[model samples]
Target: MTLLSWSVIEYSAKYDAAGELGHVRDTIKWGADYLLKTFNSTADTIDALVAQVGSAATAPGSTQPDDQYCWMRPEEIDYPRPVIECQSCPDLAAEMAAALAAASIVFKDNRAYSRELLHGATTVWNFASDRAGNSSYLHRVIDSNLARQAGAFSAGKDHGVFSWDNKLPGAQLLMSRLWLFLSPGYPYEDMLRTFQSQTSIIMCSYLPVFKSFNRTKGGLIQLNHGMPQPLQYVANAAFLASVYSDYLEAADTPGWNCGPDFYSVEVLRSFAMTQIKYILGKNPLKMSYVVGYGQNYPKHVHHRGASIPKKGGDRGCTGGWHWRDSKEPNPNVIAGAMVAGPDRHDGFKDVRKNRNYTEATLAGNAGLVAALVALSGDEHGLDKNTMFSAVPSMFPSPPPPPAPWKP
Candidate 1:
């Protein structure tokens, strides 16, 4: 949701000129409104929220196959789905805050709607901070211990990817960006600074030269952290890398220093573009991970909606197995949909049943959209170089030129 908001917010001018801004806003509003409904906005104190609706299973003990177990259209489900509510979940609350905050930016032209979104952001951010007190207490204790022992402290292990389950990195980046747009004398200035610092750390960790993450032989950033199915995460990582570069450009920062190494913004952007190109058919197999793109792409994407024929009569939960197992290309093309990508060796199997390499997820596509917008030419058709200057030196200036030879 946050990524979608970012896509429209960062590129609204370009999209508006292209006559697509209204459509994007309508789509983002649909999602934001649904998220708003998950909790009671009017309540004096917000706590729990409906975290999930339904599941892979249709009911507690029903023999009917559910969405995950069978290749059925969502419209075919006739059961009342169960819901999962959560309380005291800081991570979830923080992510909601990020989404609402970013959406508020997208609708800033609509004063009333923007205000409502900001209010929701404030509510959830408070909830997250309140629930995270225990962690803050532990950190304080650790700080005191270190003060007494004069011991060095580390920032601990880094997360390999910014993902749905782990929203800290993305949330922090959003919160920090919010600081720039907020009014003066904001009470949360300190917290926003912390967010900025943490966001910088996460981006620095992705530097290939830093050896913090592995890169595929084809130059795709691989932050799988040893997961068997890793390509699902590459899109999200690429999104963050691109978005961070946009942030740096917005702040007029030529580059950032990570310890002894000073990385120019070009370095960061180069890393992001590499990942994007790899997904768009720069890999060993020369296959585009996105459907309906490039000369070669995945034909048998693992999605029931795409696989089943529009005119077919066998659209039932159990009856679609023939289409699912069929060797033919999908009757419907999910254009611009990014599927889970190739293996470590840049190898990909185009078979429909290979869900690990064939599934197209909303989160993955959200990231892809935002990343594409960020890397595209700036607003008013201005190239990025025209808007931002050349890279500056990260170290001391060189000695002055020698005295003139002529007198």
Candidate 2:
């Protein structure tokens, strides 16, 4: 699920780097189309989305002929696929809202698809917000399902496979950004109110001032989770930074200045860029957590399908367990996947089972896409409708300088 949302946001920017616009559109559209299938614009229920695949009461692939310890292929799995839907969860609704809204921009040239995305985004947001008070009921439904099923079902109280407590603000901001774009700067009453409400929550409650979300000398966002601290808030910070960059553009201050505003654009960009560089190989670990990118990286990604085809020392019964430094390199390469990352001291322990350091999924990379695209000077018409279109028209270039003097 995280992979679905994160894929759209990051793949678009990845295409920007590679100049493969068609591939980027194709990659993002795949996830966006599936997400649309999960949602119903007229209804305010989870029926629009499939809460679980495979065994509803048990884990995926649990029905295979092989035992629990054996590898079971997806085609061989047979189980009752029960779909669950409810209205109490706001987090998934909000994520879908953000995902579809962002994709709306990606498909802006396609009027019907873009409008459909907006409708879906608005529907999910209203659905979630209407039942915000009843969100606590989620635990009951999930726990009851877990009781009924004798398999490894991902039954829990949370609204997602992973919690989205810190991610809500970013989701809201992205949705708000899409709202503004679709409005074409003509803000409607409901849309404007939603934007204001979301922006206030972020600026007044979750920014550098918030104590529960921020507790560090360096201002790293921290949560009470057992995993590393920065993972909780860094991505959202990057998203917020992109949103802030948009804010700065609208303000149109001379030379992209900062500090005059309550939350400076420069501060936001600095935090976003630092976190991005850290993931791209700029820490004490000195390893790029992004697979197949730069410097040293974790070879043994904690992904089942990506590693299933390996051979030799890299492919035994326990071959996937080769996370230690002495282990053979993982034969399969999962490119552009951002793994679970480093500790506060910039230390990384790479292993397939190390969810703290080696787990990589689509959810973690969504913000990576935002950071990269914003850092790319809005090359893909994100902030602008067309690339290099109006800049030269608005401000004529000064004459070139004389040939530089050779040393």
Candidate 3:
């Protein structure tokens, strides 16, 4: 949700041009309202928040199938789905604060609703701060460990990926941007600067000139070897890299330095563009990772909602499972859905059961939307290099999936 909010905040002009600004805001508000509802707050303090909405199973040791094991639609979820609450969860609280804060900025025109969002952000931020106790937040920990030396900022490294499971890299960049709005010595000023410098390091790491990231033979960044899911990380890396380029342009800094080497903003933006183009069907398989984008995109997306038909009768949990193993293409098309993408060797399987390559995630699509918007309708000074030749006139059979990548 935080990523989704940032997507709008980063590309408001594009959304406005598309006549979808209000729709985007309403979408964000829906997520923000749910976030606010997760908090158990009174006045200025939060007692606890719902950390999780669904459990792994029905009971502690029961073998009964429940939410996690079931594949039924949302309306058919009648199982014992419990909400897990937590008190000292700084990560969750802080992410919620960030989301609400960004959404507040989006709704700033509506003073009343904006104030409500700002109040929620403030309350959640305070909760995160109070629960962290000075030892948990990234900046404070870096300060404690490095004694606020220049090396303290430079020591941090970014894997060039961000998602629901990790918010540290995203938080650092956001806080770094927030630092520009603060007065010197305004309590967390130094902390923000530390984050700012670390953001620089993060951006530096993604630049191809730095040679920090490993790219596949077909030019896709090989970070996680495409295990579990790959496109989400690629999409996130592209989004953040593009955002940092925009940050440089906004700050009028011209470029960034990765140690001895200096990379222009154009280079950074071009790297982001290369990533976007790769997903849109420029890879080894000449396959678009996003569904419903090009003719050669995935037809067997590993999603129940996409694979199953929307008939009158309710297809209970067991019925849904039958659809999961079907060999046919999905009955429904999830347009603009970014799937898990190819392996490190640029190999992809369009099998319905292959979650690693066919599954689409909200996080992946959020990043994709942000990147697409950031680079939309503009192609000034982009790298036009291709990793492989055009698809053969006479198509050949695809090679088997490569062995698991080793460092």
Candidate 4:
């Protein structure tokens, strides 16, 4: 079912790009068929999910309700309303609007969804305004939903609030995508403000404390602590630099990991690199790094001297053998090197020896490389295909004025 939905969206996107009426018709047909299939197979499951969510929302001592289930409520109510002709029908007009906007891509005949998408964007704008007006720490309120949910949990110990922090990013990402398609008249100033404000907090609080060491050269230097390497900082820098290339100079800073784990590093680097490339017109392929080989040693090595675990025997006697061997380059550093050079050479080796790669050695520095490539229009030794999907589309035509809603 998920795959079907994804394919429908994907094909619809292609059809939209082609702008062929017949293709659009075919795309809509496919989407409607998939929707019918989903409705038939998952009707009971959907009903159950909606009921559960509604009950939770209405129950005594109910706290913050989950938005996922809340979204489903509108879906369930809207899906059935279009099929029924009763005077006292469910009021799922909002949900219907969202669904129609989503489906309109596939069914070009329904341009009405474009207006719905704009309305939804306005709704978000309004919510953001309301929160900003009321909250003292507007930045914190906008940056994370965790604090809000935590407060709810404290207030209502018996009835837990469903946390929204994890889901907020995805929601924002989607809304931003839809807004791109709808091109609403309202400025994206609020969204940009929130992003920049959060970025500033991250830079001020974390970037200064990152510690850098030439793992190959064997020396520890405190650069900054808690610096979210290639992910948050690098990505943020890349975005800023793209917007105002002068900031690229600031990209040269050592990065530090908040948590010492492969997954954490991977997530940070991948997300940062991807965003940098997308925003700065850089080659994503060049940003790609190898993982699981301990190839990039300097980035992973702890500046503090390494220690071996003690080995003990059953007889309360210490064993001569060390539990784990201490190596100059941590063998477990299995991660890919950031893409570098117009030739797309593995930049890891240059940085690994710690000879010249300084703050410039930061993985996000690749964004600078991208910026250079883009500015120079250098096609040589660059992979265009890596960023083919990341390029933004032309602004969609302004939606027709919304029709008056009938009761």
Candidate 5:
């Protein structure tokens, strides 16, 4: 059962990524077949169990004498008998129930999938509603539908799931682009408020440690000694913040520096770039000040101890590298930039180059650095190049001159 469930999820992702209408159709068909098969097999077992339960009732000295017991009814029996019972009849019923639920979900998902395949944005939005009446397992489907419908109303354009309000800041940028394509007259203020709400939760609550650390460098965000320390929470929190720009505002808070070492920083940056085109409009070139204390240096002290040169079998910076060794970048940088406009070419260029560098020489580090650069621009100070260089439109230009001496 687990394998089957995973298969459907995996295939769905693959089909969505394929971006080909025909491929999506075929993938949905295959998924439907699997679901139907599982359902039928479960149903057959249920039928056989009902027959056995009836036979048992008829046997001599059985506790169940006549049809007097309400539980005697086949439908009333525990669908998937409890472990204590271990009776085949109950087990069969349980399996059947699960299979039916899965089938129902697959049906709705297929409808949305089909509508997307046809490039019918309106159809997809209409199908996204919870009209199917299966709330327990279909809440995600409903949410997804609501988001997509909202996006359709905003943007005149249509794409598969890509044209939906994802409740995440980074995701919103992508949806906004589609909305623009469709030319829908959406309420920008309402959208911004929604993003702000999600960001506040992620920054203040989810990653309080990171927030604390952002306020005080020596605080919890830096402590890695104890279990469930602020570092892990910060990692996760930063990840959430990066995807949602509301958290990006948190970056403006003092003491926190965006860089590759911060795990969440990089993750968030990647999400933002994929959805948005550029970071906030402040061009990196406009800022003459560059602080080197946090740039390009490792953020976490623990990482310094973990570092080993390539020849010594050390991981050798294989993971993502940040702008500052210690400070983590905000994730929404990418998405923000993408949505803002193409003028931020320098920032995008920096991301592409840095991403390539990390990809070839230090694969893991590249992702981290790329995400950070995308988020905070060059301000975190990993390299001396102007933050302006990281914008998407700044391509074809040579790397910016090294930073001038600090002092």
Candidate 6:
């Protein structure tokens, strides 16, 4: 969640929307710091760290709700958080990779901080890339018999990330693409070539064409494209399209382009815009999955923080927090959040219990911010050579070919 939040805040700040750049910097620092802390604090020997923290599951048919039923702050939990740490999950590592790499660019002026982020990103990417595939430890964790016994998939069905196994390649591709855009020279050049190869394979399997499997009266909401798919898949593709568009926007200037196959930047931008609009409100559902986007947006978003209202005065922190599952509307709004999107047939039910349609997630937000950065358009005032644009100049200058072998 912190990673996703940072992705949005960083892009918004870079685009000058998450308040002023200075204030947004501080906010983004909090997230980056936490991710760094989480990775650094771990004593495990793995080169990568997990991106999630959650309690162990209850037995199937368990009548009692999880800790969330208590309706208390996370600090108030009776015990230390029980979590399954994927010390080397490639998907999680890839996400962290993208987050840190992006953060490094955002904080490029702070050389030390940017280097720290870069170092972390580079390490995680290396670990994830080395451990990519079906037999990886991450696949074991998500596709375990223990999880099946506990009905985790049944629960996750409400959240739309049902088949997490297939997402790693996409995450890896995006992370590699982003890293390639920001890096130059030596090991990075080698890394970029490796990424381009992986991207070719991934693109062929997931999104070979610029266009979607969308029909005239149907699209992602219909889920008519494939089996057990997550909205994030399409969303990730759109974000990649936007990334390509960003490259094109910098084509003549930033010195970045994927290949000769991609020339019509507007086509990519248009596809991105189409997905963004569908997410915002233009789907057959005619409802905005994001909070506060449209008149008919989802009210009962499945988020803990947004369900609670601000407490002050007599209503202090000690009190005023409880489960209030009423139709009175959430007293607080999780603004700028993107929920799990509509079902097939563009059907949607705005219910907190229907987490598949209402839950907000890190992957969802990461994709959202990427699209938002593009949709918000470029901040013309900022220096053009800041992030990806600055990459070409960072390459190591040759040593004049050893002075023409002056032996």
Give the top-scoring candidate (TM-score): 3
> What is the TM-score of each predicted model, taking all chains together?
0.77, 0.61, 0.81, 0.23, 0.22, 0.64
lDDT tens readout by residue for model 1, 1-407? 78788667666766667687797788789888887787875553587887888767656665566556567555565544678898878778778877887788888779899888877776776677664322242233224353233211235444536777765566566655654433123344655665666677777888877778777788766777544445556767777777677667666767777887778878877877788888898888889888999879999999888988776635676677888889999998999899988877777888898888898888888878767766776522212321112123224578999998996
RMSDs, each prediction? Answer: 10.0, 13.3, 15.7, 19.2, 23.5, 8.8
Top model by lDDT, which number? 3
- Candidate 5 residue 253 C-alpha distance from true site, Å: 17
What TM-score should be assigned to candidate 2? 0.61
Instruction: Please state the error at residue 315 of candidate 3 in Å.
Output: 3.4
Query: lDDT tens string, model 4, 272-377?
Result: 3444443223333222332222322233222111112112212111111121222334333323333222111212332322322311223333233333232332
User: Which pairs, if any, clash in model 6?
Assistant: 158-355, 158-356, 222-344, 222-345
Model 6 residue 196 CA deviation in Å: 4.6
Candidate 3 lDDT, 292-322, residue by residue in tens: 8889999999887788787711767666777
Between 4 and 6, whose lDDT is larger? 6
Provide the lowest-lDDT 10-residue window in model 1.
Answer: 382-391
Give a tens-digit lDDT track for model 5, residues 1-407: 21122123223333233353244344445643443332223221222222222222445555543332112223223323321222234323433333333333333446654332222212111223212223232223225455555452242212111101222333343233222222223333344344333333333332333332222211223212122212222222233334234223333322122332233544444434432221122233221011122223111221222222223332222222321132433221211111111111222222221321111112122122223332443323221112112123312568889989897
Tens digit of per-residue lDDT, candidate 2, span 1-407: 33233433433554556586676577678877787776576554544455444332237655332323333223333433456665466667767776777677667679898888767777776665554333343232224343234121222322111234444344445444444333323223354445444453444333454343433333334433234634534654565655555554454421222224455555556656776777787766678878999859888776655544533233333332332223455557888888877665456777765567777756567556545656665422243333212112223468999998999
lDDT of each: 0.70, 0.53, 0.72, 0.29, 0.29, 0.54
lDDT score at residue 236, model 4, on the 0-100 scale: 28
| lDDT, candidate 2, at 248 | 43
lDDT of 4: 0.29
Model 4 regions lying over 4 Å from their true place: 1-110, 113-147, 150-196, 203-407
Off by over 4 Å in 2: 1-20, 39-49, 55-94, 115-167, 171-226, 229-232, 254-264, 310-326, 378-407
lDDT: worst 10-residue window of model 3: 382-391
76-163, model 6: which lDDT tens digit per residue?
4453455555655766776666667777877777899888887776666667667333334223333336334534323232222212
